[model samples]
Target: MISVVIPVHNEEKNIEPLFREIVAALEPLGEPFEVLFVNDGSTDGTAEVLRRLKERDSRVRVLTMDRNRGEAAALTAGFFHARGEIVASMDGDGQNDPAYLPEMIRRLREGGYAVVSGWRMKRKEPLLTRRLPSWIANRIIGLVTGLRVHDNGCSLKVYRAEVVKRVQIPHGFHRFIPAIFGVKNHEVAEVRILDRPRRFGRTHYGLKRTFEVLRELLTIRFVLGNRVFYEKALLAGGLISGLLAVISLLSSHRPFWAPGAFLGGSFLFFFVWHNLRRFNQAQKEGVFHVRELEI
Candidate 1:
């Protein structure tokens, strides 16, 4: 069985049609499936529509929040509630194509990958706001993560139940799944999928959100980069050198020469100290955790 989890916010216009298309798209797989719709405080009669659809289809389930939470929370709730060997997720905005469901599952079952992400090879949205930003984001993410995924922001992806449970995503950090999963040695693959232009409401994202996403890109990079002890060493060396330099000046040693020597030597000492610290930490912990995982 496959569980499809979709997160929607103010998406009343496309909800019914998307539900129909998803049902038709999955029917060919010959596996029992369920669709879980997460309504993220939609004010546009979306909850009413979901309720009617839930009543009509026994295979459908609706999870509604009284207030709007971000997409990551909705996805986390869906993951915990899902009752399938594999879980699939797509956008509620109708931009993600349902047609790729079969192919994504096929790769997961046949190739034994923990996750399969959709790559928007050819987008159907407008050239400026939608397509261009997505293109630039994907390219920049590909370079930083070294995973070479074509679309980091595409909202179509499939994951094994275990993988979803293990991946820790903070709110607004869902787009960095590939980086997080890759660091943990989870097998991830990508395939080209179709993108559809919005037929209804305006895009939920804006310039502010785009900048926020860019900051997230940097966060992911720092999280995934190699941990070397040299960083800590450099810090220690700097402190020691500054102390020595001050002592030398107090003792009436050549002040100008002492400060320069202290600065150069401190930099070198700290570089080595930090690298050693990183090596030791890596040995102690199998994987890098920027913060305590329990939190």
Candidate 2:
């Protein structure tokens, strides 16, 4: 069985169409499947539409949130309940095509990649509104996490059941799941998928959401900070160098001025000290413990 989980919010107009299209597309796969729709506190008629669909199709299940918890939270909830060996996720706003799911699954099964992400080759949304921010986000995240993906925000993503369960997701961290997998040494691949223009309600995301993405990118950097011992070493070295420079300048025995060589030597000593501290700490606490400290 393949579990397709979609997180929806206030997309009443597109729900019926997307559901019908998904049902049609998955029928030929010859395997039992389930479509899980997570209703994220939508105030519109989306909930009623999903309820009706669930009534019509026993394969369909609805997970309702008490309030709007964002896409990552909704997806996480759906993941826990998904019963399929292969789990897939896509947007519920009709922008992500269900027709490409077969190819995604094929690649995952054949290529041995743990996750297969969708690459929106040509987005049909407004250039200024969606495309521009997405491009900026992709590049910035690529630099930060070393995960060079074109459409990280594209919701048409597939993952192995175990891999999906292994990852930790926070609010708005859905877009960076690829980056998370990169650090964990998981094999990930992508395939091109069709991007449809919105047929009904306005976009759930906005400028504020983009800013939140930048903030999260910074957070991933901080979360992975201990992994880069050289950076912490440089910081510690710079601090000690600055302190030594100040001390040498004020000392009476010294040549009335701070010596550059002395400052450099001090910085080097502190830099080694910092690296040792980090290595010893990592040995004591373990790198996996990082997930426990929600920094």
Candidate 3:
């Protein structure tokens, strides 16, 4: 069985089309599957649309968030309720191809991969707004996380249920799940998927999302940050904190401010150092598993 989890944000119009295509893609496989749609506080008619979908198809289960919690949270909610041995996720805007799912599942099962991610080699979005930032961000994330997947931003990804259990996703971590999975040495495979122009709903991407992605990437790096990383962090923090403390000490107007800044920075430095030590000693759990359940 496979659990398909899709997170939708103000994508009411896309619901039916995506559902049909998903069904078309899965029907030939002749396997039991469930489609879980996580509605992230869609202010539009998305919730009502999903209700109609659920009524029409028993496999369609809608998880509604009271407020717009973002994709990562929605994904988390869907993940918890997914009852399949294999879990898959994709965008709700109908851009991702459901036909690739069978192949992805095959790669995960036969190719001995814990996760299979889709790559949109040819994106349809504009260069400056979508492609450019994705290209740069993918490179940066690849360098930082040391995972070699070509397209980290692509949402079409499949994870072995056990492998996904080991992953911890927070806000904004949706774009970097591959790297996060690599933390425990889980093997990841990438497959090419078709990217289509959205038939409905405006894109949620903007300058703000780019900045948010950058911040999340840094957070991932920090979580995966090692001894060497912390060493550099300590050195940088020490120097910056020391300089700020010293330079501000000379400021006769705000003399106490320097000490406070120094204290704050020192606390941060030691905190990272502490984490490094504890992380180094912690044992890494091997692949995990859960018994199959009815969807």
RMSD in angstroms, all models? 8.0, 8.1, 6.4
Candidate 3 minimal-lDDT segment of 10 residues: 285-294
Ranking by TM-score: 3, 2, 1
Clash count, one per candidate: 13, 0, 0
TM-score of each: 0.73, 0.75, 0.80
In angstroms, what RMSD does candidate 2 have relative to the true structure?
8.1
TM-score result, candidate 2: 0.75
Error of 2 at 135 (Å): 0.8
For model 1, residues 189-281, the per-residue Cα lDDT tens digits are 788876788888877875566775666664454445443433444566679897987787677657578877986787655644543344344
- lDDT of each structure? 0.73, 0.76, 0.77
Error of 2 at 134 (Å): 1.0
**Candidate 2, residue 257: lDDT:** 45
Clashes of 2: 0
Q: 139-253, model 2: which lDDT tens digit per residue?
A: 8888888777777888898888887764445566678876654434357888988788888998887777886786566456544455456456656666777787887877777
In terms of TM-score, which candidate is strongest? 3
Q: Tell me the lDDT of candidate 1.
A: 0.73
Deviation from native of the Cα of residue 220 in model 2, angstroms: 0.7
Which whole-number lDDT from 0 to 100 does residue 268 have in model 3?
Answer: 65
TM-score of 1: 0.73
